[model samples]
Target chain A: MWYHIDPSSGTPIYRQLVEQVQQAVASGVLRAGDRLPSVRDLAVELAVNPNTVAKAYQELERAGVIETPRGKGSFIADRDHTVTEEERLRQFIEAADKLVADAYRLRIGSERAAALFAERLAEAERRRSGE
Target chain B: MSDVAIRLAGLTKRYGEKVALSAVEMVVPTGSFSALLGPNGAGKTTLIRCLTGMIRPDGGAGTVLGVPVGPGYPPTALKSRIGYVAQTQALPERMTAQELIGLCRGVQPRWNDAIVKRYLDLFALPMKQVVRQMSGGMKSQLALTLVMGGQPELLILDEPTMGLDPKNRHQYLQVLLADSIETGCTVLLSSHDLHQIERLADRATILVGGRVAVSGAIDDLKADEKRVRIAGAVEEAVVLGVEGVRRAVKEPGGWLLFVSGASEGLVERLRGLPGVTGVQVFSQSLEEIFLSYA
Candidate 1:
């Protein structure tokens, strides 16, 4: 699975991981039953502590976004078994609100913000389709 | 067994009236990975030397692994149980990496060749190359391998990653952290590299002018000290009114505030204030913190 992180963002590293994984699941880039890399491997790739990656994974598991099995690795949870659409939408909107507030504080206009987000979504979709 | 692997109580060291260290108290917990960080001449090296029995402290009494540490008490047993790698390269010029490893194994009572070979491979050190001909990074790796091969219960390293390239530094840090975890060895390392310390150290002690300016778990230290930048004139009262702020300073165009505890919600509150253009939560880098203390 592909992962992207923006170090410039003030969000903590673990939160970044959590957000990226959630986005991947929401966009269908990470399908259910796809085994994710182990916490150690992800930490090495990201040059972060394994404990931080573990914390992210634990939170994802708690939210039913991922599943862990003994002696096996974590995998994306079945969508039907995960949170309801209402709850997922609520989380997405909360994140969007934070991003919008930050953009506004930086003097980004509403039109520019909306256009930039749409461009990013299209780019992501293009990449997924190419894959 | 005491929880502390090393303890210093009011330890003082002076070099001909130039006070190197003054009445410093520190406790290194058993099996904990601790990093002592300071700039040059901050007495980090002096403190490490005293702990390793290389030099005597002018005052104070303490113990290493339950053995009394003072004039009459030799740290013989403690020395044997602790492996030390000095910051400077100290490998014999004529000896090859493998030969030095062999020599160290002969001198140490409890040597493990299997571990030595594993580390040799892990670090990708050329076993046949002469120590004198080895690159700076290779020599550092060999020195670390020699110490780690002894499998001491306590590992004391003085800037293990010094003089290494970025890749070598990362590799060395990984080995150090892995060794600490697998062996449960108590480690006391002195380094100026903040990013590496952030990654590897479980706890850190910041030494400024021979005294601990701050010391605690890495996360706790970061969480307790918040870096806040606000875009307008900030009153002392306004800053003090912030629940977690411990210190505040107004820069030319912004205010830098240090919060003593978690200030997760302070950003939102600050954003709603008039004339506030930004509210950022930041953790001071080790270099920044050191400079501020200086």
Candidate 2:
């Protein structure tokens, strides 16, 4: 799976991997049964510790986002019968709350912050539609 | 998660007449980002070499990720799992950056071409330029690229930012920090760049004269050593004699004191001292603390 990481950010590595994989799955960039790189391979590619990659994979597996076959490799799991929309929404809201809190701490006012977030969402949608 | 990636107990090393490392004990938690910091001749490099299995320890037996580190340890299998980047420029002069990385990919069990390309691009590295023609900073970056592209379970870097310009150093550390964050890979880097260490490391071990002067979480060390400024004609000796003071330096018209296990009470004590006008608790920069050790 393709991934990018920022070292200066306060977010931990495993969390970044988990979030990226989740986003990829949600966006259908990673389809059901799509074979992702092995933990070792991904670790090398990302210049990260193998254990760190393993932790991310483990978390994804626990979330039913990926499956691993012994001696084979990890692959995207079928999302059709996995997490429901309500659960997904719950997770999304939780993340949004954290973002809002961070923004609040940075002294971004509510109205402007909401407008900025909407702008970002629209930009993301446009990019997704290849506009 | 509790599995130890590296364990060293009573580890010692010497070079001819000088003791480089003396009875050092350390445990690098699995998937933790740990830094070793020390002044010149403080044995940081020697400790790093021992941990990487490049040199044998004199007085201790330990395991690096369950493989015995001394003689009779599984050779290639264990060695392959470790990525080591030394302070010195060690890349072959004839090979270009791309060629060198490609060579590593061929031998390493785990290699990521995409990751390698991304790092090269991010660092603005010249892929086709020969190592001999590269600048010092470029060579250092190339060395780092080689090790990072290998993607070992444990990373041991000895002053990886040395010889790099400020911009290159920032880029290098950014990549290094990103790798640690994204991979949860265990990292043991030795650097005199205290600010970088403070920014990147989860925990740190300070080596002084071949011994562990201090070892703990970075936050813990910073909290323990409170910077106290006493504005008065205080004698350096008297300030140093304060119960909690670890070190004291005479500044213009005052004394800057580094007190271990500092608290509000300690500040009050300093303020109450004879000839003291103002006593304030300040944060000690990592550089200041490192220099104190020296």
> What total of clashing residue pairs does each candidate reach?
0, 4
Model 2: lDDT of residue B11: 88
Q: What local lDDT score does residue A41 receive in model 2, on the 0 to 100 scale?
A: 62
What 10-residue stretch in candidate 2 chain B is worst by lDDT?
A: B283-292
TM-score of chain B of 1: 0.85
Write the residue-wise lDDT of candidate 1 on B26-79 in tens digits.
Answer: 888887778898888899999888888889889888888888778855545566
lDDT tens digits, residues B84-112, model 2? 88788888899888789879999988888
Chain A (alone) TM-scores for all candidate structures:
0.63, 0.65
**Per-residue C-alpha lDDT of model 2 across residues A1-118, encoded as one tens digit per residue:** 4587654343456677999998897665777899989775676556555555777898898777998878788989887456678876787799999998999899999998999999
TM-score attained by chain A of model 1 = 0.63
Q: Per-prediction RMSD in angstroms?
A: 4.2, 10.3
Give me the displacement of residue A130 in model 1, in angstroms: 8.4
lDDT of each: 0.78, 0.78
Runs of candidate 2 exceeding 4 Å displacement: A1-131, B1-3, B231-242, B248-256, B269-278
